[model samples]
Target: MRMKHLAIVAALVLGLTSSAFAGQKIKIAGSTTILPIMQRVVEAYMKANPDVEIAVSGGGSSNGIKALLDGTTDIAMASRTMKDKEIKMAAEKGMNPKQVVIALDAVIPIVNKSNPVNDLTIDQLQAIYAGKVTNWKEVGGKDEGIVVVSRDTSSGTYETWSHFVMGKTRVFPGALLQASSGAVLQAVAKNPRAISYDGIGYVDNSVKPLTVNGVEGNATTAKDKSFPVARTLQVYVDGSVSGAAKGLIDFILSPEGQNIVEEAGFIKL
Candidate 1:
């Protein structure tokens, strides 16, 4: 009877150990635009559930979706909805991409703090990016030549800008392309004649955000759809997510997660 009791106790201990060691882990990758809010969500979630492990990375939205389809990541963060081609590509790989809208973002055009140009009409913006308006003087600024800073093609922000601001027109070849919003901020902040566009969450006193068609880019404007450059922020999962991935998604859509989104300067859904 003593030997049987000891065997039962050992088995219980081994089972508990195995369960603890097999705790869920999830991988998330994608948009720099969504990085700040996602990081905060991950931090809070990890703190609440110490057993679960999550890895987050930003390599632009395209790379994130690619990682998801490639089976390397459980979640893909994106600022724009998945393209039909991307959806078809995922289907070919036997993966169904599901999107969860987490927040709303406004892509605000920014210039140096010293820039005197306060607002730009959509037509003027289109001309500026198209290289037709090369000098600041033409747009009611200094006589200095305009230095255009743009996001790389891999960025969802860039795609949105191309669609709305550029009117499907390609950015001039002379524009300087940066890989992330932070880089665009840094470049514009230092160059008085430089102009760029980034998510409103990234705008601070370091740069001046331009009014689009007399409308300001803010959470209020974004929510009302008055902001012309607004886009929805989302996270993509493979069909139905389970375990850690689902937990993270659930947390992001929760009240606490929405609070984090607002605190990060994004508009909550």
Candidate 2:
């Protein structure tokens, strides 16, 4: 009996050891928005291949890119396209940046639920950020001062918003610069006089999404090119990725991933 028990224990130990060494854990880092979607995909992959492990993190696009360059991360997630200089830097570093489009997110301009203003044209939005439009009454809202809220320069959302909405114009001095999309949503939701922008994923019942040039920002509008603020969510792969990393990307572009994107309040691309 003792000899038989020893044989069984030895076999189990060897099997466990072999399994541990069978596959490698894939390291990944991404933007906060991409984190959830990526996680869902990874979890699904793990169900089929239990030997693989995936690690994810978020420190904004720049930070994700930095991690890839510095070898701290294997995958970089971005909400916006890489800048020309970043692509050049990757080349200089002997790293190839592989871009995979995952989803579409509208840079939804939101206002306090109490604010009656609902519609805005491109020029009017440009004026508001450029300090030209100061009163809500000018755009058919309440006869109150227009309080501008915005994201800081470090935010990729701000970069896109400034480019598409401001048209290379500046977001006038004293505009409230929140840190993240959630913060922007919160500020706009609570302050009746406030107006700010966010990722479509952040839109909810608490705040109201404005119609830009009379175009609504739903998945349909984004797909039809009517959502003026719609932007692509991207995943950047540095060097060759393991099956795990590739699987995560594939999932984001898959039906399940798109479902998660839609459930998160963003548009599925």
Candidate 3:
């Protein structure tokens, strides 16, 4: 009888081990701005749930949404909400895209640390990007020509900057365009005359984040909507996601997952 009981226990242990090793693959692709946060979150989640496997990649927000519509990625991470046209496309394709807000982000205008200019009003920012204000001296900086570095048209960051700063005015045709937030940061960090913007999490000491309209962008301001460029970070899953996809989204919305957001330098929900 004792031998029989021991055999049953061993079988149970083996079954548990087998299930734990069975893989549930989840693919995430999207906004480079949210990439750092998701990377850390994926690391923690995978450690806690060894049965699940997750893959994450960044190709800008527009491409991420496109991947979801094409039935490629399980989750689409974005720094901006999906456009009406994108929703229409999803509807026509029989795809039900559900958005889950994960965090709050402040779009910060950054410049080289060596630059003396610290704060910029909305009007000043608009004029600078519009090619109306051509020199730094015009906006309280040194007597040097301003080099405008902007995100490419496909970027969600570019869309946010356009809505909040540019209004109807278009970016200067002469401006330099980068493909990602990291690229914009690098471009500005390497050029004293260059100015650009990015999500708050991507801002580092290499570049100085200027105060917009005398208000600093941070967790508090972003959360309260006091910052001029505050926006929500999100993930879009097709239809009603179940299994590992749902688990991952739930984990991101959990307290511990939100801690990861704060650690990643964004405002947690």
Assess each prediction's global lDDT (C-alpha) against the native.
0.92, 0.79, 0.93
Tens-place lDDT digits, model 1, residues 1-269: 99999999999886664355247988999999999999999999887667788899999999999999999999999988899999999889888889999999999999999999999988999999999999999989999999999999999999999999887688999999999989999999999999999997899999999999999998889989898999999999999887677878999999999999999988998
lDDT of candidate 2 at residue 63, scale 0 to 100: 78
Ten-residue stretch with the least lDDT total in model 1: 14-23
Error of 2 at 11 (Å): 18
lDDT, candidate 3, at 17:
52
- Which digits, one per residue and each the tens of the lDDT, describe model 3 over residues 104-169? 999999999999999999999999999999999999899999999999987889889999999999
**Candidate with maximal TM-score:** 3
> Global lDDT for candidate 2?
0.79
Candidates by lDDT, descending order: 3, 1, 2
lDDT tens digits by residue: candidate 2, 1-269: 99999999999886774465247677777566566666776777666557777787766777787787788887887887888988999999998988888888878888999888888988998898988999999989999998899887766787788778987789999798886667778888889988888887777899998999999888888778787887888888887665556666666787877887777676787
Instruction: List clashing residue pairs in candidate 2.
Output: none
* Residue 236 lDDT in candidate 3: 98
Q: In candidate 3, how many Å is residue 196 off? A: 0.4
Model 1 lDDT, full chain set: 0.92
> For every candidate structure, what is the RMSD over all alpha carbons to the true structure, in angstroms?
5.5, 5.3, 3.2
TM-scores of the candidates in the order shown? 0.91, 0.85, 0.92
